[model samples]
Target: MPSITINGRPAEFEEGQSILEVALAQEQEIPHYCWHPGLSVVANCRICLAEIWAPNPRNEGKLEPMPKLMPTCQTMAQDGQVVYTDSPKAVANQRSVMELLLINHPVDCPVCDQAGECYLQDYAYRYGRASSRFEEEKIKQPKKDIGEHVLLYGDRCIMCTRCVRFTREVTGTEELMVQGRGATEEIDVFPGKGLDNELSGNVVDLCPVGALLDKDFLFAQRVWFMTKTPSIDGITASGDNISVEHNNGTVFRLKPRPNASINKWWISDEIRYGWKFIHDESRHVMPMLRSRDEWPSPKAAEAWTASMEAATKGLKSDGRLAMMVSPMLSCEDAWHLGQMALSIDPQAVIGVGPVPFNGEDKSFPGGYTVRAEKAPNARGVRRVLSALGIDVLDAVGMEKALSSNTSIDRVILTGNYPSEWVTPSFADAVGQERFLLLIDTLPNSLTSRADVFLPGATWMEKAGTFENVDGILQSFEQAIEPVDYCKSEAQIAMDLQSALSGQKPTVFNAAATRQAMASQAALDRFVSDVTLPKVPQTVESDMSIIEL
Candidate 1:
């Protein structure tokens, strides 16, 4: 490995790595706006300029200084290279760049959406001077609604060209371009096209300043007040890592977490905006049990004893129970539900629920993908069932069994799909004759027909693993508590198990359940193969406050 000294700190680097990349790896501060690891390096942001010194071959290996400062982003690291980013010359250049960038920038920090997380705000505080030198009027540009999900504020843009490069090099749509010259330059859409690509929302994330903003989250909440939870994409099988940012139990936005193997630095607009269903008013918030006369109670309960008792009224070892596990469930949820069904009747029919698909998989030039399969855990459900020594049936097979299997008189169905997933044929298959126990997150025809219905939690409200289409197991943490009166499917399954066995109910723990699954010979991989998202650490400052 080649070694370099950056600002008195020595670090090792691999060949072809740039000074900015190495500095970032070492956790050193190098103020930058235009450089992103996933995008091409244009080095237009002069804030990362650093003085360089290299060993001279002709002068008996003596250190030789370069004539001028270099852009750390574009300069590759060399062996025995010395870089100074905090020297007087470098600091002067940084102050100058910050001063220039702020000349036309509006003083909208109090009203800007990116106030706390804006790189411009951070650099301005660190590198800017006390007052402005310019006496002329600041240029003011109007905000433009560029696309369905993105808004462009021309005056705030420092012309880093990140958005322009993303459209041309990543999506290959070429919808965004730089218009006009020098100080008056601005980003604009093509004549007949808008920034309406499937990945257009990413421009908002790529913007280092408030120039680009998400239309859906424009004035929703301040960044500093929200808590970000590491989570995986639940709407698709792409398994893109993401951060669920929320405040007061309300999710404000979903931003991509960098995963080199999965979604690198960008997530599709569908995944970014697909979390609205989690807080929709139509979600089920109470457990209900139909009376003998077929009327359901309107109130919810902390202990759903009546619903559990109704679900297990006639369940016996007669092998008359069939379970349909939805693809929207986590692997731990599916496993617990499956074990409970088998405990009631050893020969119970366990099958995976309906998996939704739309069109074909769409691939982008930047290596990001949009999957056709809308469900997140179909593969995980199938894997758990297979490990339990059960031959799982597909969605069609389960529907057919429900229609033809006259012997099955009790059914346990779990549905956590984001939208309405019930069909007339499927409803008719599980006819009114049999006992239907449904655990679901949303209202549909089945909720009305179920003999006992329990409100279930969404993926965001639960902690568990999901297997993607590629058979990769990824785990996510619970972002927020379950919506009022709603419980996780895993907890519902455990409660039913306790009710049937006349034992005390145990609290469901995702990690402990996974360890129990790993105890089985076929599922031992669950302990080792599941990929957990990295938890960010909070660094406390050493500075103490004094009362004035």
Candidate 2:
């Protein structure tokens, strides 16, 4: 262990830790812009300048200050070394640096999207003078559309080079570069080239100031008006951690939540822009049922209740039953669905549903990847079925079994896929069953043929744990309420189970359901002594990448 004194306060740190790292760990404030934990430190942002002290050149027993100020982010802490982050000398140097950065910055916080959480605003308040001393005209640079999702406000940039470094080091696209020199310096993309990398949305999150902005969320909402709910992106099997930003029941955007073990400081464009489906107008919001005449029944509570009763009758039969567990569901929801199937018929066939696989895994230079497997919980679904001693089947296997086995009269299918996954052949084959019940979040090719359709909630509307491809189970909380009249899978499952038991069904309690699932033998592996890292706080800070 090594120790150092920062601003008259003793702080302990590791041997190779820097003064900025020690200060931030102790909740001490040290203004910075160019340094990021996930990127190489260039020390271009001189805002973190601090006075350093070491053993005197003439006398080894005495301490003396270094003649020049050093960047705290690049300077490693030594035993007995004394550093001053806010001393008179350090403050004077930082204020001068801040003044230089603001000489060209426009005073337009009212129209800026990053006004509430902008680092430049905070730093200017702390280290800048009340008024600018420069009497010359300010430089004005035109805004440029550098990428499909990124817009650059040249005047707002302080030449921190965070965005340029992100594309070069993390994405390896090299689409961004610094143009011009001195007062005319600005970030620009190569001609005929835009930042279309799979990880391009990360630059917006990496930007400490308002220079880099997301085109999708430009002027959408103020940061202070929205609340962030921690969750994981269900668009891919990676289960990358995320935060859903919404205001007044509307999701404005999705940003990566810093999880050092999983996603680290960046998230792919899929996770960043995949929340649009939540607001799609074509979502299946109301429950529907097919009458004896093969026509959809009119919408009403009676229709919904009648459909539930019909589904219960189908499940409470002596005939063979089949349940298709979707990878889009959490382990807790899948477990409940499987239990209800077996309770009706001990020999019920249970298997995983369709898994969407696109191109091969697209990996970046920084080790971030977008998996080809689009499903979020396939491994989790398999774990549940394996624990229940049920044989897993694919779409082909389930269709073949249903069509050939006359004894398989009842079937339960669920899917929340972003795209159409049910083939016409499979849907037509499953339509032959005596009772066909479909549970889904959106309408698809198979919905029209289902005897009963239950509108299920999306991953954003429910709370549960999902096991990634590597079998790491992580929990996520519900972000927003279910869209329109949709009901959660847990709630629907609970109601159906109660109806089967000849008792009253109550509303779903996610916490209680998760607690009850802890005792299940199938879920024991996921919850047994497995501890996930705590999610970082959602409050925006003066700095984005504090770890150095």
Candidate 3:
């Protein structure tokens, strides 16, 4: 093991890891670009340089402690190494490099996509000199129409080359290449085509500067105003965890979050732009009331009970009950729905609803992505169904159960697909049944046809867990308030469960819910005393693991 001192703090590391790796491992701040651990170490940006202190010549063996400026990313840490990430000289060098990069940059942080999280923006605030010294006119370049999906504003480039390298090595698209020389350098797509590659939008994210911007997200909203919520990318079978940041109730942008075990550094464009469907003009907003039934405001339990009682006056508990838990619903919500199903009869048929998809699963750069299975959490729904000992029925079964000849007369369906995921025929089929109860985040055919409709919270407003194809459970936190009077499906299902089972509503708290879930398990497979990971804000450096 190589030992190092970072800013007077003792640290230890593997022999070959760079100083940047050691510093970041210890959570020390160092600006970086073009330094993804998953990719080849280019060390292109000089921003990560640090002062490596060493011994005086006479007392070299004992480390007398004088320092020298070095590229922290390029220097390998060896035994008893010492590094200063905050030396005056090192700090000055970083500032000067930032100034040089800023010389030709356009003054557009106000509208730029790389606002809050931009390394240049962060470095400028911390390491840069107060003002720019350049008197020359800012450089300008034409927005090169790259592919259909990408527009390259080469002038905004910091020359990170992350996109170019990604195209060449990861996607093998080879549609992008650098052209011209030095100051005149520009990015150009191959002639006769735009960025037709599957992994194109990724360039927009890879660009450290606004050199590449999603034409769709450009100027949509000021970055600072948006709130970020962690959610799983619903577009893929791998179920990559993503951040869905929105302004107000409108979804503004998407980005990848680090999930070391699953989606390491990238999420596909399907996961990226799927929110567009959420903004679909006909996307339902308010709760729909059954035509023959009068619905009341449900701000509280009494109002909700009044609403339910008024809507289902003739329906009885013995009526064959069905609850369709959408794959889009979170695991905790699905579990609550499972509880609701058993609460109704303890033998009710709980069917999995429609999973929308076109055809083949699409693979993008770095790995397979955006599965043909359009739904994000089908596996999670199945997990709930299996755990609760309910029959996990699919779309085909749902259709069969809703037919006139079937015993399932009262059915509850939750549909939140961006498009018409549920068929009109299915809606008509369920509608003709004795009772159709609809729960959805957006308006769809089934919601319109149901006898009673319940509003659902969009991904931004809710917190829950999702299980990917491999059975790894990833948790998401709520970032925004519930959209338009809708409560989280978790809250709805729990309330319904409490109504059915005669127990108090037990909302899902990440830590408490796990224990509750374990208690519900009948065997060793579902038993675990494990606790939730520390919330990011509460994590403490002093709590580092103690070796046994």
How far in Å is the alpha carbon of 507 misplaced in model 3? 5.7
Best by TM-score: 1
What residue runs in model 2 are displaced by over 4 Å at the alpha carbon?
Answer: 56-58, 292-303, 529-548
Residue lDDT tens for model 3, 147-263: 655678776788777887888766777777777887767678767867776557877877777778887787778776777666767555566767787887778878877666676
What's the CA error at residue 376 for candidate 2, in Å?
Answer: 0.7
lDDT of each: 0.89, 0.83, 0.70
What is the number of residue pairs that collide in model 3? Answer: 4
Over the full model, what C-alpha lDDT does candidate 3 score relative to the true structure? 0.70
State which candidate, 2 or 3, has the greater TM-score. 2
| Window of ten residues with lowest summed lDDT in model 2 | 291-300
The lowest-lDDT stretch of 10 consecutive residues in candidate 1 is 293-302
Residue pairs with colliding backbones in model 3 are 147-194, 147-195, 148-195, 284-443
TM-score, each model? 0.97, 0.93, 0.84
Q: Residues 1-548, candidate 2, lDDT per residue (tens digit)? A: 67888888889999878788888989888899999888988999899999999876589558988889999999998878898878888899888988899898997899999998889998889888888998899999999888889999888998999989998998899999999998998899989999888999899988988988999999999998988888887878987888888888789999887777778888888878876877888877778777642224344466568879988877767789888888988887887887777778889887888788889988888878888988999988777767766777876688788778888888889988776778888777676547888999767887877888988888888887788877788878888898776777767877888889988887766556666766776566555634343655766565677677
Ranking by lDDT: 1, 2, 3
Better of 1 and 2 by lDDT: 1
